[model samples]
Target: MAGGRKPCRAVTARLRRSVNRRPGTASPCPWPCTFYSVVAGHLDGGEEVKAAAIRDAREGAGITIAPENMRVVGVMHRRAGDERIDFFLVAERWTGGIVNAEPHKCDDLSWFDLDRLPENVIPYVRRAIESFHRGVWFDSFGWEE
Candidate 1:
């Protein structure tokens, strides 16, 4: 939503990995974590947005999700001396399993509760999750205005 600049389109997935608890505890714990990533050059020229989401989810997290199973959860206008638009999607159902497709690029891919996310998560990604829970459809970050 900046001036006349066309925002770059990107997609991220909020795939809930699993549930966990302390070593001997028997109580249900919060959702372990949601998946996320900046689509890795998979968005071909004018490719369908949902298609890109599916591809990203597969390549980044090793999950195969259909377009119909995905939902746009939030959009983030992110700036870190540069600006871009990110589309966040949530997929509770998918075929196949989760794996680190790009192990070289990711050091750790573990489940984390939203209330206790890792300190190293991308700032915009975290904000997008917060916005999703708040039912905020749109948000801007790293801008003074």
Candidate 2:
């Protein structure tokens, strides 16, 4: 269930229908699009659901990088099935902003020294932070296909 290579069944279903199924069925993540949308409304029908992310940055501890100065440097594509991957670049710059919980997606957030991180930081994010310290690179490298 972890770490192997296979074509996306989702993409295959789009190109050739299964023998037992009809053709032209709409597949998820249809071709050539990385953007999707979901409709949301509050129970009161007066609110809109908005997706959000909690981002934090830390610098020092024998390191010269800063998440506050991060930038989108490159995006590597390896069409696993029907999705494109993204990677953001971070640089060293000083700034001050409290690491707080992500209102929606991230339930908690905090800044940790390179040697010490929050107990609940996502696994993938923790890996990326580690890679930064080792001078290796990781961005969605351990996620998805």
Candidate 3:
């Protein structure tokens, strides 16, 4: 998805980027957040982007979907390091409905149980979710990091 058309930048929030506490203190990013990673071959990214997406997903936060493919992004960055895995999410595939922030960007959004996802899901997404349970988040370029 690559954030659709525009490039995404880190906000650098203390809560979001709490470079405080211990190295492995209570998990860095939030859970259950959504990311908009790319879906293709090859990998490209740094530790920062991966962290953002993982934190977003673990914290259960939702993100805006890109207009290009009509899907929301979700990063599956790992805190332990080595960019474990990254992934993307098609907004329409989840349950519930889309948010009202950007109508054109996203039409059908859903808050999936996160525990039980639907069939035909992207491979990388499945992997990310699997790692999330163990707190072993990884970074995958096109996966959704």
Q: Model 3 over residues 1-145: C-alpha lDDT tens digits?
A: 5646423333211111111111112223222223321221122345454344333332232333223323224444433223343344333322322233332332223434556555433344455555545555344434334
Q: After best superposition, candidate 3 residue 17: deviation in angstroms?
A: 21
| TM-score of each candidate structure, all chains considered together | 0.72, 0.35, 0.32
Candidate 2 TM-score over all chains jointly = 0.35
Candidate 3 vs. truth: CA RMSD?
A: 15.8
Q: List the pairs of residues colliding in candidate 2.
A: none
**lDDT comparison, 1 vs 2, better candidate:** 1
Clashing pairs in 1: 32-112
- State the weakest 10-residue window (summed lDDT) of model 1: 18-27
Write candidate 2's Cα lDDT for 36-113 as tens digits: 111111122232111100022221111223334434333333343444333434344534533322233222232335
List the global CA lDDT of all models.
Answer: 0.59, 0.29, 0.33
Best by lDDT: 1
C-alpha lDDT of candidate 3 relative to the true structure: 0.33
Residue range with the least summed lDDT across 10 consecutive positions in model 3: 12-21
C-alpha lDDT (0 to 100) for residue 60 of candidate 1: 67
